[model samples]
Target: MQDTRATTTVAQSGHATEVHGWLKWLEVVLVTGLFLAAGFWLRPDDPLHVGNTFAWPVLAPLLIGLRYGFFPALMSSLLVLLVAGWHYDKAAATAYPWGWAAGMLACGLLAGEFRDYWERQLRRANAVNEYSLQRLEEFTRNFYLMKVSHDRLEQQLAGSSGSLREALRRLYGELSQTRSEGLNEESAALMLRVLARYGQLQTAAILAVEGNRNIQPKALATVGDYEAVSESDPLIRYAMQERTLVSVQTEFRKHLKKLDTDLLVVIPLISSTDDLVALCVVESIPFFSFQNRTLRLMAILAGHMADMLCQRDQTMAGSHEWQSLCSQARRAARDAEAFGLPSVLLKLQVNEQDLATLADRMTGLLRGLDVIAVNRANESPSVVLLMPLTDELGLAGYLHRLELDIRENAGRSLWDFASQQSLVVKTEAQVAEWLAREGGAID
Candidate 1:
């Protein structure tokens, strides 16, 4: 398929080149003929008169040089000289007409060289612009990814304590219970409410992504006086295209053709699938503290909101459950080591039958601080559970409960499950070693 595409591209390029060449030659012929006709019409009745037709021929070569370069212009100049020599007296043509022909050739050559120089400069400028744009895009993507990693780390830290874990579990339970289809608008309104409370931004709006990939305002939450901006505002368009947060500035405002509002920032809500699901635009508060970190936090919240808006009637975790668990485990490991907190890593090999039911039971058994990740590298799939701040006694009790639950609910005996548990230590290297021992890397 790739070879066919390559062949097609080459064939199309060749055809375009051939057509361009023919058109260029045709232009030369038409210009040359026009020059010849003009010379004939302006020729003096007496042969020795040598009228202003001598000067008229220069236009042909000058235009040819500007459009088609030196060689074609030189050819046209020579043809003009031949016509002049044929129509005029030999003596008169040989003297000044030869000088005029030389002047025409020099003009064509100089103009052609200038044209080539201009084209070279333009190509270089375009190349530089393209390289700069590529670097900018790379920087934006990396920055956004960094912000996402930071947000995930914060979540991991928040889930480290027992009380926070309980709170998170309750929150997740509530969200799952309330999950429904076509709740995008409510989700956007909820997002705006959260953003307003946290950022202290009075005015805000959420734009949802449509089927055509265009974002339209789905919800607008306002507290005080705010400017009304259209759904197709330039700031929203910029954020969508760049997939990064943008600050409103004079130049961007100019693009919008209106500066009615005190709009401060535009946040892109990118999903786990890397889709830009929505945009959140916020108004800046006067005398309120604002910085890059603030915007980064807002972006993180907006990302969660985007996930909510894109959710359907499926598992509340959506398709990124595995990835989310892996990220949580890695972050928990780092935090455990940094804070000298106890943690346990459990690796379990379970029967493939009723895997989904087994997973759900395990999820119910574990705290929000704990993560369950599936490792399918081996012939049979296995599960790895990361429990933060759990001591040996806690690990033992949890495993016993998990075993009883599986035996009674899944109708499996204790022998159907093979397991290993290790105390998590300080440092990423130690965590990596633990994952390696479990037959998988920290994804």
Candidate 2:
């Protein structure tokens, strides 16, 4: 196909060149004929007539020079000289006849040189334009490749929620293994491993609450040769009493005597039944701020650990929650198909910074029946919306409206990061197929 196109282009260029050659010859012939015709009709009877058609010959060479170029113009000038000599007597022609020919030749040469200069300029401009066009095409190709890579990255990050869910499942699996091995020794080791992996902690201890409201601090795990502090430590006491997290600082140095650590964090593990099950004492570098998401994650892990310690069955609630949401969407899709109603599922990629605001706005904007799920993974947070009665066109309109609202209220930065992908799934089978194709599974 490329060869055919190249051949066709070459053929067209050759044809154009031939046409230009014909036009150049025709221009020369027409100017020469006009000169001859005018000279013959206006020839003076007096041999030495000052007003004889000498001027007509000048035009032929000048026109040829301007049109055909230097060599052709010079030849035309010689031809004019011959014709003028033939028409006039030798004596009359000899009188300043060479001067006239010289003038015509010089004029033609200058005009032809000017024409050549202009043609060279035009060719250079065309070359520049061609080079620019080639660069533009290359840039477009590179931009497309970059876009594809970016899309793949986004897709990978989009699966982060699933990845987190998988990690949680593995944690549960570890808990199951511990249970099978008789929970006393194995459970503490597994819990320490889980904590070290997720909470980024090194030196830590776990304290269990006894039935008599007394808490016993146990050195469950230690990463280094470190002394463990007692439950009576102020940090631990405060964390347990407040049922919240506490970090050791300069202000608590007096209270944390003998616990000479650069950093310390105490997290309370509260059970599902509102009972304080245990407290996690972590001594490490001061890494996390109070409001950091890592702290929140640590708290969540502590809760799960508390549940595990309380002998509660690990239900994989996070995974189950997502599964339930997908099931609801699937049911909604099936019902929509049965009732011949419209339904659209929209997947939105949002900037992590704008996620909270966007979620709040979405909740307010969407219909009551619309299901919105925000995957709160830090890598690439996203929101999924299942619009039960919205068709493709309706979805488009909704998107447009949302975009306008974002631009007006949220500004351009928010709008820039908010991108949506939509699918019209009318049946449960279609939804399942889409989920499978996209590597999405609730379980």
Model 1 lowest lDDT segment of ten: 1-10
Supply every candidate's count of residue pairs whose N, Cα or C atoms clash at under 3 angstroms: 0, 0
lDDT of 2: 0.62
| TM-score per candidate, chains pooled | 0.39, 0.41
Model 1 scores a C-alpha lDDT of 0.61
Model 1 TM-score relative to the real fold: 0.39
**Residue pair clashes in candidate 1:** none
Among these predictions, the greatest lDDT belongs to 2
Which residue segments of model 1 deviate by more than 4 Å? Answer: 1-179, 217-226, 249-261, 286-289, 311-347, 350-365, 369-381, 384-443
lDDT of each: 0.61, 0.62
Q: Which residue runs of candidate 2 sit more than 4 Å off their true CA positions?
A: 1-163, 180-183, 211-213, 248-262, 285-291, 311-443
lDDT of 2 by residue, 156-231 (tens): 5563322333444556667766634322446766776766666656576665566525677555455544576765
Residue 68 alpha-carbon offset, candidate 2, angstroms? 13
